[model samples]
Target chain A: GAGVSQSPRYKVAKRGQDVALRCDPISGHVSLFWYQQALGQGPEFLTYFQNEAQLDKSGLPSDRFFAERPEGSVSTLKIQRTQQEDSAVYLCASSPRTRTDTQYFGPGTRLTVL
Target chain B: QQQVKQSPQSLIVQKGGISIINCAYENTAFDYFPWYQQFPGKGPALLIAIRPDVSEKKEGRFTISFNKSAKQFSLHIMDSQPGDSATYFCAASENIRGYGQNFVFGPGTRLSVLP
Candidate 1:
């Protein structure tokens, strides 16, 4: 309740199956971001949302990757037709307001595509 | 695409010793540099940060040294402790176009502090 929270800390999905991850940002936070981190690597930005508007989805790897923040508080990342290479940790972060604001991060959801 | 490169993919340091991690960026537009500490099963958290305007920033046991001309920066952990062992990541971003929310993080350095 005090920090960002994510659902289904671990997910095991078969290849070609679809999966969705959820993120609940800090209350009153106006910025949210999603990132994908592969093994032994840092987080790579996947998308960004400013309030309820999806400002950027340039980082999404493919059309199968979709994200939406309808209310500006909770967000979801959906991956369709998942592949083995899609296995990675999905992270969610929220900022208070401005660009310079400190970002609070969630524990992240580890997606395993088998 | 902006890239942040971090070195010493893995490190082992003794307790009370100083641990240093280095990072370099290719983008000149990046004005915000931040170091994040992440433990297993947890997301990375902001450890310390330094802007290009300043050459150095110190907070308690952590220090960030920035070199504008070389586009390099480093994180120094003074008196490293076992509890400090974790993965450290360096990230860069620009405030332009509200893109600050999208940070380009380095490959990360896994630090192991031995007691």
Candidate 2:
């Protein structure tokens, strides 16, 4: 694809329920990132992947939040036991390389925890 | 902790006026700064970027002013237009790290350009 793409543009999950969001980065992009944005707030970095390597997960709020890019292309962010506070737009971005490169973002998945 | 801080959570500017948004960072390791513009229901798009080596950079009607000593940066939109109304975010990153590593973003500033 020409740009990064995310699945399930909107999702509603009951409290304690599990949900998974998917992201497909631009073809051949070597770097992928995940971010969380609350209402009216900026996107907060959650994790980063260099190809299939999960290099940084420092920003994940809790142990329940997990992300993986097994094939170095498609990625998925899974949240277990969702809470109301977890409600936000999850953004996915990708870049060409590890150097100072421009990141392209997806439309984002708006998750609502009820 | 948030490495970057932004001001003027919201602003109203008349068309043809200038819109300015400021951001400050605490980390000196940051060398790259970029601004993003986002409209409602859409993802953010890169507007302009500047490196620490340059004090200022201009592209079309957008300008980025950098102050390495103060660790501050600002975005200036000349002749602001209604189409320019959107949320702007300032972000910083270190070159030593990978593209997605430790990228810090400010809280964001929403600009409303009125005709």
Candidate 3:
């Protein structure tokens, strides 16, 4: 079975620019989550989706962050007006169903804002 | 605020020795506890998990000891090997609406096993 995967393994953007990171969850996965991991820190939850419905967005750091999962299998995390503080690895994970606690994670997209 | 706190930011152990990492949580509502292992340039993978119902669970050489009354849990690696070196994260979540909600992660512990 294919594992969850993220695109643009690495990205560099200038401050004030916009960036979008993509995630492809395992086929048929019903739960998708986004997390941010800073250097030497554990991953922090940013948002969560159950199928196509965005269930939780409380973990999003600020209004500049947005996420969507229109089709339920793929998701995108968009950061507007990127800042140097946003430089970190963006990780995506998925689970079988809403209640499943075991999450399978993607390799993650490392974003650097200059 | 960070709900979970992990101790020993880093650890080094020799092969065949025992390795232990500890974590504490403040929320009593957290019912599901899971540990994740991550290597450089890779995403975290589920190492092992335990619920509040169990005091301890062992899988192969990895063991999780949970102390419900103290709101603490720990991971013990027996006969540590070089390949076991990586970063370990402890996380907790409350079962809400049939889903594990609002996971709180610890700071993480970097473990290095020397042969």
Candidate 4:
């Protein structure tokens, strides 16, 4: 009955620093997704994973953003050389299949790069 | 060219009044539309969803009206209450891979219901 959860609810990093955000999907869920939400804006897709394989990562802003889901359970979104523009809430969601099915979202990790 | 455009940015309604939020999408391949509700410091929660097959779907006091020809959709909340005050987002989903989906979200509309 537990929903998706994210860690380090808040993170403040200096420019050029590296940060890794973690996401734990719901039990038995087969689909995982990452999104970035800016202030006063809706969330934009960052990457998606089906089981341990990443199906789409075209939404990733740049090469600095890397995500991996090993063992088909937990996922980590890593941002290398953080920039001021990277400041936003990173959201993770899990679903049984796709967005057609209801996806449960995590509280999100707010990252601020100064 | 995949974009879900939401309008009115914000809305304020009195108790018992109706609240309506509209969204238009450019992609016709989108087959699933869902509305998400979010409160401060919380993740978005699914409010209602509609498939292209149906013109309209109503759940409790929330209703989703879909216009397939117009490529638009709207959310109507009846007897809006203060508890219903939150940000609403309209999203379009299209399945790309075997089980992968692409979600295009609107800018979002902040709704404030006065007591």
Candidate 5:
């Protein structure tokens, strides 16, 4: 079976530019999550979606970060007006059931803001 | 505020030795404790997990020791091998009756096992 996958493995953007990262969750997975991982640090949660409805987004750093799962299988994390501080790896994970289940993580998209 | 705290930002152990990484969490409501392993560019993989109901859980060479009262947990790798070298992260989450969960992760410990 295929695991969660992310696209544009590496992305470089200029400051103030906009970028959208994509995540394809496992087939039939019900829970999707986005996390940001800084260099030498643990991953921090950004948002979560169960099916097509977003359940929690309190972890989003600011208003610039937006995420959506329109069809409930693919998700996109969009960052508006990228800043130097946004240079980090954005990871996506999915679970078969609820968030309590084991989560399969995507390779992640490394974004570098210059 | 760091909800979860881990010690020894990095660790190095020789083959056949034991590697131990410790973690402490502040929230008592956290019922789930899980450990994840990550390589250079890959995403984190679930290594093992334990619940507050159990004090210890062991699988193969990995063991998780949980101290409920102390709010601490540790991962012990017996006979550590070079292939086991990776960054280990400890996370805690409460089982809220909802669609989402808030997982608080530790700073992570980079483990390097020497051959």
Candidate 6:
């Protein structure tokens, strides 16, 4: 409510297992984004949605990485067939407008692939 | 390819000193630049931002300097405090003739402020 929120702050999955992370954006936000951050590195863009429309997904590492904002208020990022390299912090951010604006980020989900 | 480049992988500064972090980008189309600050186990927060139209912008103790010709920008924290110790990232984005814009972030700079 106050800001962006993410569920399952931490996740541990075995190789080949599938996992889904959820994000709840600020109320009435029009833009949502997902990013992956590896150890000691900055966040890399994964996908972006504008009011339930998947405008861009070119940054997703692989086809296994899929994201959806069906209702536009909430979003989910599902990773299928996880690999060791998939272990990283997944971040969700929301902006008030569809155009460039200040984004509020959630705590992020730390996915550890064993 | 890395669209954004940052210098000084890590920095240590004393309290009350000026802390500076630099970043460069190759894409001239990037018109918006923002700097984010992050703490351990937390998400990044928007510290300050600047547009290409202005050469510099200041808010409180933070300042963003932009060099349009060189496609470079930097963040300056005045009177650094120990509480300011964190990782800083510089990001750039262009208006993609679409509904939303994508961001390109640079390798972060870890700053430690000594009290």
- Which residue ranges in model 2 land beyond 4 Å of their true spot? B97-101
Residue runs of model 6 more than 4 Å from their true location after superposition: none
Off by over 4 Å in 5: none
Q: Interface RMSD value for candidate 4, one decimal?
A: 1.9
Going through the candidates in order, the fraction of native interface contacts each one reproduces equals 0.74, 0.57, 0.70, 0.70, 0.74, 0.77
Supply the TM-score for candidate 4.
0.97
Clashing pairs in 1: none
Q: For residues A7-109, could you state the per-residue lDDT of candidate 4 as single tens digits?
A: 9899999999999999999998889999999999999999999899998899999999999998899999999999999999999999986544688999999
What are the chain A TM-scores of the candidates, in order? 0.97, 0.98, 0.98, 0.96, 0.97, 0.98
Candidate 5: what lDDT?
Answer: 0.93
Q: Interface Cα RMSD for all candidates?
A: 1.6, 1.9, 1.3, 1.9, 1.5, 1.0
Candidate 3 is graded, for docking, as medium
lDDT of 5 by residue, A5-37 (tens): 999999999999999999999999999999999
lDDT of 5 by residue, B4-72 (tens): 999789999999999999999888988889999999999999999999999999999999999999999
DockQ per candidate, 2 decimals:
0.73, 0.64, 0.76, 0.68, 0.74, 0.80
Summarize candidate 3's per-residue lDDT along B56-103 as a digit string, tens digits. Answer: 999999999999999999999999999999999999988778445667
Error of 5 at A57 (Å): 0.7
Which residue runs does candidate 1 get wrong by more than 4 Å?
B98-101
Can you write out model 2's per-residue Cα lDDT over B1-115, one digit (the tens) per residue? 4479998899999999999999999888887899999999888889999999999999999999999999899999999999999999999988653444457889899999999
Q: Point out the higher-scoring one by DockQ: 2 or 6.
A: 6
* Clashes in predicted model 2: 0
Model 2: reference contacts kept, as a fraction: 0.57
